[model samples]
Target: MTDFTLLTVVVLTAIALVTAALLIARLAAPRTFNPQKGEPYECGVPTRGEAWFQFHAGYYLYAILFLIFDIETVFLFPWAAVVGRIGMQGLLSIVFFIVVLILGLAYAWRKGALEWK
Candidate 1:
């Protein structure tokens, strides 16, 4: 009836559905364990080097920058879908959002986050 009640119902329903699905899967799915499944492998060849080798921090910085821009795409899509209905206000808001993202990207670029080396 009320907004809070509707939200509570939706949350409870989602929890219940997820619980049921997981329980059903646990009960119905086949369980098989093999020794080969536990080993580290790649391209059907056994790995020779240490599995826990440290990577350069620059790689992580590049990934984080990519993820930030990727999320910008996610936000832009829904806004674009309702752009006509939202008019000038939404356009200005999204423009601001895009400007901020562009600034962030520029900062990353200037700092060489995009560079492989």
Candidate 2:
């Protein structure tokens, strides 16, 4: 076989072996199931009420807004790091990106997504 084919076979074999080992370990582990064990346990206290609960729409809206700004910050850090190497074109591109980002935030705000009450 060619070198590439040989390397591929070796990698695949390693992956298969690791998977089999993990499966064997899992199967060999002890298994225990009881009525209380299946139930949710919180801070040594028995869980009360329904496990699935609906969250307020406002909470979700705030979370989405937080995520959007958080992601913008994340992207900004890397771009800042490479700004010198990228020059004016990169700066303009980032400006455009930020403008688009601001527009999205504006749209969300206009739709009342930013309101707490």
Candidate 3:
């Protein structure tokens, strides 16, 4: 009914759900014993070479592109759906939004964030 009551209910529900899930997992899990399980491995085989390796910048490029275009598409769809009613002001706003996004891409390019390797 009230904000505090709603918050309390949400928190309690989350706690109960998490507790239930953990309890179920603990009860249902296999108890097999293996000395090899204690050792660190890649696909159950011991790791070779360095334990850590540097990730490629391509991951960041993909993520940034996905974020930018994904958001652009999301915003553009709704605007397109109502294009006739919003007039020139809406058009200008979207143009401004696009310009800002281009600026972000330009900044990323200048910083060499798009480079692969």
Return the top candidate by lDDT: 2
Can you give the lDDT of residue 78 in candidate 1?
A: 93
Q: What is the lDDT of residue 72 in candidate 1?
A: 87
Q: Residues 35-102, candidate 3, lDDT per residue (tens digit)? A: 88877777967766875787876897788787876888988999999988999999999999999989
Clashing pairs in 2: none
Residues 25-94, candidate 2, lDDT per residue (tens digit)? 8999887888788877787688889968897789988788888888998889999999999999889999
Report lDDT (CA) for all predictions.
0.89, 0.90, 0.87
The runs of at least 3 residues in candidate 3 whose Cα sits more than 4 Å from the true structure, single-residue gaps closed, are 2-15, 28-32, 40-44, 49-51, 66-86, 99-117
Kindly give the stretch of ten consecutive residues in candidate 1 with the minimal lDDT sum. 38-47
Candidate 2 deviant stretches above 4 angstroms: 1-52
Consecutive 10-residue window with the lowest summed lDDT within model 2: 35-44
The RMSD of every model to the true structure, in order and in angstroms, is: 5.9, 6.6, 5.3
The backbone clash count of each candidate, in order, is: 0, 0, 0
Better of 1 and 2 by TM-score: 1
TM-score of candidate 1 against the unseen true structure: 0.54
